[model samples]
Target chain A: MQADQSALQCNACGGLCYFSPERSALECLSCGECYDLGQPDDYLARDEFAHRPDVAEPEDNITPAQRTHQCQNCGGEVLFTGPALSAHCPYCNGPVVLVSGDAGYRTMALIPFRVDAAFAKRLAQKWAASRVACPAGLADVVAQGDVAGLYAPFWTFDSDEVVQYWANFVKPGGKAIRISSTKGQMKIAFDDMLMPASPHVTPLIRDGILHDFDPRDLKPYRAGYLAGFAAERHHQTVAEGIAANSADKDLLIRNHIKYKIDRTGVHGIRYLTDTSGIHYRRILLPVWILHYSYGGHAYKIAVSGIDGRTFGERPFARRRLALYSAAISACVIALGMAIGAAAAF
Target chain B: MLAETSPLFAAAALFGLSTYFGLIPIHKLIQMHEARHELRQGSASRLRRAGGWVVVALWLLTVMWCAVFIGDWWASGDYQAASERAWQRIGILAKLAASAGGVR
Candidate 1:
């Protein structure tokens, strides 16, 4: 348990150290002194699915809260609930890291937070201001709230797929309908099909948050990288992630076959695909979530920490929309009158 | 008089409808792609931005040419000649399509 603690005790002032996103190092909270955590190791990926953890049963979606670890700095027992990888020691305010027993199942990878809290808040404010229906004060409300940086878990699957498809093609002629049948096979290799490893984050939200994230940004996971921010351990295993993403993969393969062989008007398309050479890597992606209330209704905004891309819900003013409608209508009417005058002349 | 030129009006209406329904969305897509480039440094952002701008520029150029043709027709007070010219262009297009076996 002591080995999991990534905090460095300040020699000059005995304060709990936090990972500074700005400097990419550990800094003492009391003295403002920094300590370099050294270089990150190479990320690892495994191709075998059989080597997955035994606890990866279909129903085993919860990380046990009973996993207790003692904080080295304060000697306080820190209880990890759900899939939380790191948390502050309640007694002495020291950071405690919990190593989920499934660490050996897959070599962990993580993209450390590049955008700091202040920048994330600024991004949220800018996004709020750009919203067409946003109330005037919503930007200020979002900017005032603290942005919580989280390292969300994801499973990236690599696979070699073979698809066999058959379809009937039809065309309408001047006097008769023509029908033809065709069959074909396709081979495709997919490098990464990303899937969310936590049930808390939906697939749609995950795609929005990690839209264009490059896997090259990821480094081998170390508790040092997760010192300050919250990290969620992977509760859904490799099998579960694959099951969740298989339908989309199948659709992708079918589309590839369609593009390669058939024209746009193909009908009654059917296919069966076989996937092999399947590999998966478990990774943590950084996101900053901001929550604010407008007219008593709460909304959440998530910004990608790797890049400043923001996504969220914002309240819209009905009056503004009505005004926009009126303006567009007036322009259209004026344009019509001008075009009519031209035709008449 | 409007009923006599209903076909011309229909073509203009179609153009306006397609511009609002189709071209507007494509323009919004260009804006979105450029915005993503500014924010995310994505691998495909640059390519998408360039391609989107080319498409928008081509659409705008076509619209400009149409506006110029209409201005010249109105200036000369030769609306019948302008309509005949449009039909002649469409007839040439039909002949090309028939030669290419696209029109049966």
Candidate 2:
């Protein structure tokens, strides 16, 4: 026996309602009724030590991308890979919300899909056609691929970093001249440093999915937003995601310091950095993802649900590459021969 | 003396120096452009591409300037003469500075 899974039902006609990206409202599929979600409250909780009772801490040793969900409609086993949110049961086609987390993992905040499925499909077609090495038949191949709209789990960190740095600037001429050493302190404040909280999602994929997202677009978590779309719950703790990006953040801070002080000749620089007043919030961002096979190889492309920004690995035409390489090599060899002849003379 | 006057050697040195100092930023710009391109942010990608080209053009111009300087030295055969003139000018400027400062 599985817990009852419920979806948004239209009050007018008893039809299923889905969150429409274009309308930014819920639309009934049967009666074509539109319901506005109105404004979502901006509630950002900032207690680093606070823990939600419903949220379970990740295991000390962690490895799991699969979750089992028993569909309430048909009692069929629904296998969810990664942090996927919503799917239809194969047995009954009933919409099933695969909650991978405990009650604590309920909706916190989300960036709803601004680009709808139709727009996503059109963008996919346009992107495939514009690809440089795309086969002539790639359009047909892409047309058959399934595109799923889902919200990926992310941890947005806000903090202020203060760094104490020391650097030795060499004299204009050389070390033989008087050397000047300087020490200074710098403070950098950043908000919404969003990192993918799902272990399977990388920064690259997240950027591909939500290019230049405005944090203002984040809405208070509502079950209605997850009505039509699949949502993934965060697997990695906020600390873990921050730890994953700590080295890069350090490098960024160092570069920023260098940019400020390394104007002339910098001999060496050393710095110590501390991030304070750290706060974080969990949110889900929309992405349109498709994995398709072409020429016996699989390819994946993701489009930002907020914007139409697309990113993916595109295949190159081997035949065209070989021809270009041959031509370039021939020209290079001829040029070398002509240069050698002139040198001999 | 020949190496000093040859534009090729000077150009090579300029290229090396420019490359050593500029390659990292150029690589970063190109990477930024590519990342923007991947995300289909056409305007942003174009901006990055233009910035990357500006850096390349600046490096090229620096190398060209060095080559032109070397060419002038070789063509005029006045490398030593130019150095002597520069030293004389510096001496005159220093004397003027001393006089203005009432330092005899």
lDDT of each: 0.58, 0.58
Q: Which ten residues in a row have the lowest lDDT in candidate 2 chain A?
A: A44-53
Candidate 2 residues lying further than 4 Å off, grouped into runs, are A1-7, A40-106, A165-184, A261-270, A323-345, B1-33, B36-104
Number of the top-ranking candidate, with DockQ as the measure: 1
lDDT of 1 by residue, A101-124 (tens): 432233367887888989988998
Of the true interface contacts, each candidate retains a share of 0.00, 0.04
**Clash pairs (backbone) in predicted model 2:** A54-A104, A85-A231, A86-A230
Superposition error at A62 for model 1 (Å): 11
All candidates: interface RMSD: 10.7, 15.2
> In model 1 chain A, which range of ten residues has the least summed lDDT?
A45-54
Q: lDDT by residue for model 2 over A82-164, one digit each (tens)? A: 22344654323446655452322433577778898878877887777776535677767877877877677777777788889
- Candidate 2, B1-104: lDDT as tens digits: 54454544644555455445554444444345556466423222323333444444444334333444444444455666533443444444434332332110
For candidate 2, what is the lDDT?
A: 0.58
